[model samples]
Target: MFNISEVDKGDSDLARLVSELDVFLSELYPVESNHCLDLSAVSDEQLRCVIVRDEGNAHAGCGALLFHQNGSAEIKRVYIRPEYRGKKLGEKIVSAIEGIVSEKNSRLLQLETGIHQQPAIALYRKCGYEICDAFPPYTADPLSVFMRKELP
Candidate 1:
């Protein structure tokens, strides 16, 4: 079983995983070219990140949640390694992020996925997120799939 752990932004394992996440995102969305979001430093800009690791020194999956208050937050870069997919590790990472949101007393969970990413859309929808009109900062992209779920 994989263990979900929160480490400092300086953690080496997390640094590598975040690098991989950045590279993957760049490949998926080449036009954005946002390398700043891939940094290991918290910069007061990121609220929190969650990293999961197995028996090895590498990460199995990783995800981040940003707090916007206003009873809302965004889930970003939820990723799992190819070998770990279909084993529900992605769901575990997602559940962990949602739990963190709940702890922060967030009432809404909003996320952006790509239209070309059908499997991810299915996973988010299965997790109770519903399709919604694109929100702020994402209005320019017609390919972006914005979704939100209300916390109980």
Candidate 2:
């Protein structure tokens, strides 16, 4: 069984997962197109992170949310280990993040992903996030795909 739960950004497993994700994105996109937050930013108080672990406590994936003062939030650093893909873990992570958004009364949730990340784009669409124009703090970039979903 896999378990998803909130964890400190400083958690070693979470850090490792984020580092792996960073390397993966760096390989696919140029530095400018990679909008992922660094470890320092992810450790900020405004961000809440979650990690997925298996029955034996092996880390399988991780994700985070950066809350804003306007009752909005951005999903960040969502990644599932290559070995753990195709098991609906991505959906679970997104669902877990959405639950946090609802708890925080966030009216909107948004994210920026690379255009080359087809699987990510499809997962976001499956979770009801639609393609949208670049949001604040984000300018238009050909290699970037912006998406958002309004919370109920």
Candidate 3:
């Protein structure tokens, strides 16, 4: 069975996954256009980091929610291992984050992705996130695409 739960961002295995995500993003976009969160940032008490594990206890993927004081949350650092993609794990991870968002009383969830990340974009839309204007800490960057969904 596949299991999804909140995990420590400082865990060795999850840390390695985050490192790979950073490298992948760095290679895909310029530093100026990348807004991917660092491990320390995700480790903050305000963010809840989650990991997916398979039946044999292998890490499948991970994602996080950054809680703001205004009852809103931002999804960040969603990464699936290269070998584990195309299995609908991305959609599950976001749904898991949405459950957590609702529990925390967050009324909205937002995220910023790169224009070149078609799969990520599709996943977000499938999860009900729609295109939105840039929020704080984000601007009108041609390379960036902002999306948000209201929690029901």
lDDT tens readout by residue for model 2, 1-152: 89999998789999899999999998999988889887575447689899999899999999999987777899999999999999999999999999998988887999999989999999999999999999988999999999999989
Per-residue lDDT over 30-64 for candidate 1, one digit per residue giving the tens place of the 0 to 100 score: 66634235444445445677888877756888878
- When sorted by lDDT, best at the front, the candidate numbers are 2, 3, 1
True-structure RMSD, every candidate? 2.4, 1.1, 1.3
**What would the TM-scores of all predictions be?**
0.86, 0.96, 0.94
- After superposition on all CA atoms, how large is the RMSD of candidate 1? 2.4
Which sections of candidate 1 miss by over 4 Å? Answer: 33-46
Pairs that collide, model 2? none
Give one digit per residue, the lDDT tens place, for model 3 in 1-152: 68888887787778877888999998989999999777685436688888988899998899988987777899998999989999899988999999998888888999999998899999999989999999987888899999999988
Better of 2 and 3 by lDDT: 2
Total clashes in model 2, counting residue pairs 3 or more apart in sequence or in different chains: 0
Worst 10 residues of 2 by lDDT: 36-45
TM-score of the candidate numbered 3? 0.94
For TM-score, candidate 1 versus 2, the one ahead is 2
Count: clashes, candidate 1: 0
